[model samples]
Target: MTLTAVMSAPPVTVAPDVPLSEAARLMAEADVGCLPVVAADGSLLGVVTDRDLTVRWLASGADPSAEVAAVMSAPAVTVRADHTVDHAYRLFRRTGVRRLPVVRGGRPVGMLSVDDLLIDALRRFADLLGPVSGSILHDDTEQGFRSPGPRTVDTNGPESPVVGDVMSRALVAVGADASFQEVTDLLQHWRTGSVPVLSGDGRVVGVVSEADLLRAQDERAAEDPARLTARRLMTAPAVTVHPDTAPSDAARLIVDRGLRRLPVIDTEDRLVGSVHRGDLLAAAGRHATDLADRVRFALLAAVHPDAFSQLSVRADDGLVVLDGRLPRGIGADEVAHLIRSVPGVREVDVTARPSGPAEVHGDS
Candidate 1:
């Protein structure tokens, strides 16, 4: 789905000739980020946000009563209503942007933001499945489920599980010293929606989402439309959740509280992991894929006595290749075919060496 599918009708806007202070006042009253400045005929001129006014114009001693056209971001990033969700993600990542002016016939129809993209991605998937399904289900942490998609369920029900269970331990974070530009680079590199803002001691200090940075820039435009700062722009008191909490509870906390992300905590309140709206829905996919993997293992075991016993599997860009020994009752070709049935297995290469007690070579 694109912004057109989920976007609201034309957002409120302002004229370039308006005073900087007046624009800021309107934004505060309306509670909006970046406004698209338009011409008399309704043609787009430039854009401004609270960040621009505060940092650029006001903080720098520029007259707030001055025309907004003096400091608005021009030729705004725009998207059509029919653009797909993936398209929005790509653009946001590419431009390090938070919002896009939706245009129809060259006229601003709506505004789209990374937050909207995140919410849409999750909400669309939410309709298909829940964190634990109709009811909470526990899963085997030691074993992989048939292979689930982004939402792999290690457990079935809403029982209090260990933090190590559902939490994605591999968290991507950034330093406060990192520039706004670099933050976008890191998030895009990881294809993540948000990254934890960490201090030197690894303490969770804040968070900077695509929306945050964009909003910051817009605020700057409203002010002087030039300066930037990470400290001033980040969202502090980061949202969090305990690792052992039930997925259902996490979902409730997020949905009811209007949160897009939650930092997963542990018994001691250390930042152990994170759980997002997408994570819950992804658990279901993981469950389905896990089931598929299980069947694959079973079939391989039944097909060849040592199908899995003697071989080591290696992955290269999502392709599974088998290496090592060709154990008793197992043929190299047969092993390849057997292992290929694994759910995530794409292509396989078999290079099996016949088993032997021992071999020694290269003597001085």
Candidate 2:
């Protein structure tokens, strides 16, 4: 798609000599996170965002009334309006600019945000098809789905168990306003990758993943890190499952769809727990022979399933490696309680995936 098709037209700007306090007021008045700083000749000199003002100036106790030329961040990131959306995507990620100024003959003509691309993605997936006609989710006989056999939830030990027995009642969802990085934050925060995107009407739009954000991050770094934003990074036309979906069926959906996590929504399409590939792995009592991978995946599945909780439970070695997702958005304490409760379990290894860093949501 062409950027002109979606770029916000005729962005506002301020002169380089404008007082920093005035620039702050302009941001507040215009309800924009960043503003273009222009020269007398209409050439772009610098750009300013809430972060620049707060982090580089305010936090440092710089004079608020200083001219923007003194505190504004430059050189500004810009793109041609005639370019394709892909060009804008490249520009944003490469420059690490949330809002890119569209230039024509060195003058700002329009603006495009990472949110614009994000909104377009959600619009594309608006009203996700659950059992839509000929939908992928409706297909049966898709292998790897195992029937839930009776497992010992309670071994007459103090701990009681099973995935269905204890998932959270609340789930945080992403909106069009949310960027790809924000989804990573949500997943890393919730300790699970892949979060459902909700429309204004509360309909499920799409899902975002670390892979999506990682691709964006890589793409941005591929060009310039300062330019890319979440909108340019998300994958659209997401598939989802209902919360009451059988763990086995959900696992099948994850496998069949080649997905890392599936959004579990109610009839109203509100988000519930994330059914990750590892979640299913734990439910089936399957563990990777790569001993450490198994124990941690199991413990997380038992304790904090919200965060991309995967326990690589090595029933033989009793060594467990715990990797917690929810990067910048969440920090989870080790489930010392759940760790001690596991039968024949020995060591616990914990690695928390922080924001901006990639976390593997599904098992290899």
lDDT of each: 0.58, 0.54
Best by TM-score: 1
Off by over 4 Å in 2: 129-364
Model 2 per-residue lDDT tens digits across residues 321-350: 545443222334535445555555676555
**How high a TM-score does candidate 2 get?**
0.39
Question: In candidate 2, how many Å is residue 106 off?
Answer: 0.6
**What does candidate 1 score on TM?**
0.49
Tell me the lDDT of model 2 at 278: 47
- Measured by lDDT, the strongest candidate is 1
In model 1, the Cα lDDT at residue 228 comes to: 51
lDDT of 1 by residue, 156-232 (tens): 65443332466678877887677655665676678665687777766666777655654454475555423354555
